[model samples]
Target: MHGLVNRCIEVFLRSTYGNALWQEVAAETDVHPDGFLTWGNSPDGVTRSIVIASARRLDKSAGELLEDVGAWLSRQEQIRRLLRFGGASFEEFVESLRELPGRVKLVIPDLELPGFAVLSDARGRYRIIAESHQSGLMRVMAGMLRGMADDYGSLVIISVARDRIEIDVVLPDYSGRRRFELSPMQVRP
Candidate 1:
């Protein structure tokens, strides 16, 4: 698995739960307490072990924990910027999901994101199939969808199954959308 994936989990666990809990989970899983390198690769087993141990220690299901991680990830500036590049509105963003894997690949050649197939039914209903070697990714995607909905000021109901996610955009523009700038400012020395 890509180290960035594991590193996100590690950051989420530590920031949300505290460094002590992260260290405990790391110890239980035999992972280094300092955590994964953002650009390095680790065995998939290491990620699974960390997730299992953390979930067990927290007394939460792995799906629930990963969902939280996804939501947290959405708030990160870099991730939010990357996702916001999808479109200007919530609906447009969801439509752009079909191209997400390729977009991500362009930035990180070696990173493998889940392949997403988006199906639109009624006007505001979307069904997304997320395929990856890792388990519980659908839940994470579901959480991300929810977070993005809020970010775009849309009201949505999201449901997750083993490999699929359903999103019902109750209100496409329910509130004020968060601000997003296309370009970052250059810092002068």
Candidate 2:
């Protein structure tokens, strides 16, 4: 890889997503496409086309990794992090997400929930369908029941569906599923 093309992509990304978001995406995926501002053939046979080829290779494992997840509650935790998020509040959560880069529609039932659960980084929003090779969707139905305490009122998660999770009450929907890490202590931003 030549510094020239790399610089080109850097410029484009800095301008588009802004330094903050672009840098975050770059950190996670390790690809900086800012040079895509122009299409230049590399001196070697390996041109900008190399990026596309590599992406294809990456697609194989990444595709199946998310699909093989079998737990219904895990899926719900995934969705919870995506839709409203599991951090301090729903708003701070969505502000940090990169959108689902592809189109994959998984079935999600709108239902009541018990409490909040944590979501995972993989398969949260990157794939098309949340495929389960085993059984557990019913467990989600039961876990949601756990949120039903006699005297507490708060957003409790009941089940998981991919990056979306169900809570006791409906939250105003945010656009894309953003990944979040939960901590015991709140850090000042």
Candidate 3:
């Protein structure tokens, strides 16, 4: 896993809990307490262990922590830049999610990022299938999608199927009629 993922977990812990608690979790989980450069990599198991240990310390479910971490990541400037590069609108960005891991590869060629397959099932609804050789990472994808929706000032309801690692994205008014446009594009006749 990329150090960016671990760094985010560390940041989430420090922000949500505290520096001391982060230290405790890192010690208990056997994760390094420092030196997590975003461009570096770590064993996927270590990252997962840190997250699980953090949840136990905070008395929250792993899913809740993952979702909060995803949301917090969206708020980070580095990740915001990447998501902005994906598209200008919530719908467009979500549609381009499948390409994110590929883009991540540009920076870390050997990184094994999670893969996504986004498909439009019907109007206002989409399905995203996320797969990773490592388990439990799909929860992060589900939360990331939710965070992306928040970034666009949009509301989305997400349902996850853990067995298949599929996330169903439902937009209540995704008919494009309520879309917030900055300005109308001009057409030449």
Candidate 4:
């Protein structure tokens, strides 16, 4: 298992463990990158997912590092500001409808539950596909969100009651008509 994971990380990034990159990432998150703690509930639920992205000590101008720092800061706070820190509330997640490196502004679309959309460079026509929240579809929606969840992306909830019984918030930003059907499922205790 360790060899498989190490090989995978090496393929995507510059380094794996106990390197300068890992040290920097640990400093950014204020924890020891080499040691982590994970806890779960029952036998089927995971309460945490730890992703470690390490890079070689990137040799860049001070301006570049500052730019990266700014981007990270903005990303950390963006979801709340966009959602007004109100409305949909559950687990915290930020979906990147469209994102790329060094983009100053992000285009995000939200539709209240059981539905999602596509985003481009904010210069073309955007399309949305949706489904009304129905009782039988909860498990399917849950599975979709769970399966596609990225460390920094979002799960769209169509309604609070029926669509998303397993997530945190649902924001509506896309065009056209929408029907919020879910009635907000009670989170795990």
Candidate 5:
């Protein structure tokens, strides 16, 4: 995993639960308290351990904890800045999500990131297909999308299916007019 992801997790735990809890969790999880190097990489097990330990400590499901982490990540200035590099508007940002792995590669050449695909439904909504070797990451994606909706001041409904995830973004004014038109995008490795 990239150090950026680890750093975000550290920040999320510290901000949401406080430094004391983070210290305790880190100690229990056997994660380093010294912090992750932003440009470096860590074992994937390290992230999994932190997530599992956090879930146990908070008495929450791992998926739920990850959702909160994703929500918190969406609010971080560092994440916002990195995301904003793709676009200025919510629609653009969502559209640009498919290119995230490539973008990450530019910053961390050896890191492996997940893949995304955007498909337009006949009902005028967008379905995002998240492909990853790891399980439960899509739950985090759902929360991140919800947080992004809040960030953009847009109302959105997100649903997850067996193999694909769908997001229906409601435009402003609540009036049944001018639905967003998202161009279909597919970026595969």
Candidate 6:
């Protein structure tokens, strides 16, 4: 597994729970207390162990915990900026998901992101099929979709299954959206 993925989990644990909880999780998983390097690689077993131990200590299901991690990730400025680059509206963003893996690869050549296949039904409902070696990726994607919906000021109902996610956009533009600029320097204080 890529270190970035594990590092995200570590950051999520530390920021959401606390450094102490993260330390306990690291010790329980036999991982180094300093956590993963952003550009390094670790065995997939290490990632699984950390998730399992963290979930057990936190008294939450792994899926639930991973989902929270996804939400936390979306709130990060760098990640949010990357996701916001998908589109201006939620619907457009959903449509752009097919290119997400490639986009991410362009930035991090060695990072292994999940492949997303976006499908739409006659009723305008969208389904995202996530393919990855890691488990619970779909759940994380569900959390990210929910967070992005909020960022786009849209109302959506999202459901997660083992390998796919369903999204029902109730209102594409339900409220005011956060400002986004093509260049950070364009922002005014």
Indicate which candidate wins on TM-score. Answer: 6
lDDT of 5 at 8: 79
lDDT of each: 0.87, 0.33, 0.70, 0.30, 0.72, 0.87
- In candidate 4, what are the lDDT values of residues 26-139, reduced to their tens digit? 566454455333211111111001132232245543223322332332333332243322223222222342222113223312211334433223322222222453432243
Which residue runs of candidate 6 sit more than 4 Å off their true CA positions? 132-135
TM-score of each: 0.93, 0.18, 0.79, 0.19, 0.79, 0.94
Query: Which of candidates 4 and 5 is the stronger one according to TM-score?
Result: 5
Expressed as tens digits, the lDDT of each residue in 104-124 for candidate 2 is 122222221223233344322
Q: Candidate 1 lDDT, tens digit per residue, 1-189?
A: 888889889999988999999989888888888998668898988888898889889999989988988899888878988999999999999999999889989989899887878999899899998656444777787778889999999999999888888888999989999888787553111
What does candidate 6's lDDT look like per residue over 59-112, in tens digits? 999999889888888899879988999998899998998998899889899997
Worst 10 residues of 1 by lDDT: 180-189
Clashes of 2: 24
Prediction 3 TM-score vs. true: 0.79
Count of clashing residue pairs in every prediction: 0, 24, 0, 21, 0, 0
Q: After superposition, how far is residue 75 of candidate 6 from its true place, in Å?
A: 0.4
Could you tell me how far off, in angstroms, the CA of residue 51 lies in candidate 5 after the best superposition?
A: 0.2
lDDT assessment of candidate 6: 0.87
22-64 per-residue lDDT for model 3 (tens digits): 8898788776677375667777788878888888878888877
RMSD values, in order shown: 2.5, 16.1, 5.9, 18.7, 7.4, 1.5
Model 5 residue 178 lDDT?
20
Candidate 3 achieves a global lDDT of: 0.70
Error of 4 at 116 (Å): 3.9
Instruction: lDDT winner between 3 and 6, please give it.
Output: 6
112 in model 5: Cα distance from truth in Å?
2.1
State the displacement of the C-alpha of residue 167, model 5, in Å, after optimal TM-score superposition.
Answer: 0.5
